[model samples]
Target: PRFKSKKATRQGFKTDRAKIIKGKLRLDKPHGIKNWYDIRMSGDKLLTGELKVVSICRENGKYWASLPFEIEVANKAKTNRVTAVDVNVGHINYTEGKINTLPDNLKRSYKRIKHYQRMLARKSVINGKRATKSNNYVKTRAKLQRDYRKVANIQHDIMQKFTTQLVEEYDKIVIEDLQVKQMQMTHVAPKGLQRSMFGYFRQILSYKCDWNGKKLILADKYYPSTQRCSKCGHIKTGADKVGLNGNLKHGTKHNEYICYECGSVMDRDENAVYNLLALIN
Candidate 1:
């Protein structure tokens, strides 16, 4: 069959399952489960593996059975290298012995999804309609889910690439143990941008590091990575002292800090990154 859109392709692959039981298959509507069983069984024969667990998920009016499997592979040795990552709204900054930034793909995707959501809201308002489990509403909801899935796919892809690259190149990865829950609570910035990216990046980094046999070192949340200067052991206090503007500067209430001894202009995050790197060495 010719695929028109990703939504159609996903719908084509959905399972019509009646029940899911641990590792066993008890088929009532075995649409997704059957496919998983077949694939795992064939792969097991070819590679001598086993199916572990079968679970179910519900999203956008569709039910799915997830079959997880385990395969044996040879263990590898550790490589001693270190990288530090700092996540932000527009980009992810990292030090793989040098500074780098990852594209803000998730943020961009969210912006696009937000546009569609706004349109849907407008349509519902104009028609004075509330969504029921009607066919049209269901279809619209599915489309929204598809959009979400697409964004998720994009995020997953970017994270995989970035993590894989880091793991392959560096054995020891250091990252700020960002207080994500606290950030979410204190976030007054536009769209809660900082809160959105921090959690996902940390999750991806953790798993990828594990898979590649690399060490993930998480710096403490209160380590003051951005406030202390790397070049000199100087601490900058207050928001304006750190060269931060607008909502980006969290400690904006106080603005007077001077490195009277060295006379260095301080930028908080940059200072933090430098300090983080200093800790590595």
Candidate 2:
């Protein structure tokens, strides 16, 4: 169930001490040596079993051992519960063909972190001529990094909770496969925003659905989730009152959107969520 260090395994070099306890290889005692676990064997004689060490990996400044264990895949009747999720600038909207927006606390945290980043950038530039390794510079940089990490953690936590809720509630989830990479190249939105939260959401949803015996449907990337009126199926053209330009005229801030077709004006993010819900049904 857990990976032990290759170095740890090799230092002891106790093949006889190895015992299969609880279906796992465990050593009777710690080997008083290092780098012994780094050894690997490759051959056709490798044993095959439900519990096996698959591979070892070094990633993100850490080493990991991978174990693949086979368990009986549960048999559950497929479900008909379907929902569509929309990821927008400010909030996540989801629906079973009905409007519902998930409250996102990360937006507030992001705004605060953005403010801190700007302040840090300004301070760094102002103090750049003085010194590189100055205490003030190092302290400021550390603070900035801490703030950034906090923001990232908040975003991850929120997304996990949101995605978990959706996977648990719905059997089939539909979402637009957004062209976030292209959008980043265009510089149409903040770099942080364009970094593709959809990928993370999709990843979490995919595994959760698979484990729960559900289905996930990806809509076309270019699907007009925003332009088409969900209520009447009206293909909205131009910015008169339905598109981005219309939303700007309606006093929506950047990253905010409103739909004139349904007179349902909300935070631009909520608007995108509503549009996504429409696509599901």
Candidate 3:
């Protein structure tokens, strides 16, 4: 790992020696005037567990403390409920015919972040090189970082809610093992897929499932979930496939999957979700 730089806008140190005493965080070594700092945390539940590590960081002119703890979690009772989900470029399709998407506020946040980023660049760049920071440049950079934090928090909130809901509602959850890197390299829905955060979604779902005593099944990466007909188990080929095949635009233009073998018609993403559901049904 690279050495930590003092010039970095975001800086922090982690230590296991930190102790929590009467709702205050106290470090073993006193760096500031006092060893203990009164931290404003979101909930008191974090204080209940065995504190393991404390991380203090400063970013965007704000100081934050993160206290990670260990606790026992009782596994949820089994309900025998099962579900499958397909992560699409635009939305997530599930076996229950429910589509979940990020709210419009996230899009607005992205736009604001982009605007700040452009402004920051103009303020910092000079003669094709990044010049020394001026008062205005630093102010713009801080605004950009604030927007970055906003976007991150927004995504984190949505991810937590969506993943928690899935773990709560289903005993067994099935999802395709998507080859995200290969998809990106092949230029398949690049922008949309990146924004979708599919890999991170899977990561969150996996841990949440483990904590909730839910079973998470990963369908094979090359299982052709998107190209197979969920109704008749017929796999499409050539122009019928939902993705690129030998430079030919495959699948129906309307994003519908039609199985010639059984004449079963369905939305492409919904069909994939069902096909994944069939894996462990």
Of candidate 1, the 10-residue stretch with the lowest lDDT total is: 38-47
- Candidate 1's residue-wise lDDT over 37-134, tens digit each? 42222222332256545554556756566655476644335667666776665456666323223246655666777876876676677665565335
Cα displacement (angstroms), candidate 3, residue 62, comes to: 1.2
Flag the better candidate by lDDT, 1 or 2: 1
User: After superposing candidate 1, which stretches have Cα over 4 Å from the reference?
Assistant: 1-48, 61-65, 73-76, 97-108, 119-130, 133-136, 190-196, 207-213, 239-270
Local distance difference test scores for all models: 0.58, 0.58, 0.76
Sequence-dependent TM-score of model 2: 0.58
RMSD, candidate 3, Å: 3.3
Query: 1-281 in candidate 3: lDDT tens per residue?
Result: 12288777678888898777776677665545544455445655547788987787888767777878898988887788899998876578887765445568778877887887787666556523444346666677777788778767877787788888888888999998988887777655676677778899999999989898899999988898888888888887765566622114532554677777998877777788878888986
- Regarding TM-score, does 1 or 2 come out ahead? 1
**What TM-score does candidate 1 get on C-alpha atoms?**
0.66
Ranking of predictions according to lDDT: 3, 1, 2
| Model 2 lDDT per residue over 17-116, tens place | 3334443444334466553332343454543456544454443223444456566657345556777777754456676333222234545655766776
Model 2 CA deviation exceeding 4 Å by range: 1-79, 96-130, 248-281
Measured by TM-score, the strongest candidate is 3
lDDT measured at residue 171 in model 2 versus the true structure, 0 to 100: 77
Clashing pairs in 3: none
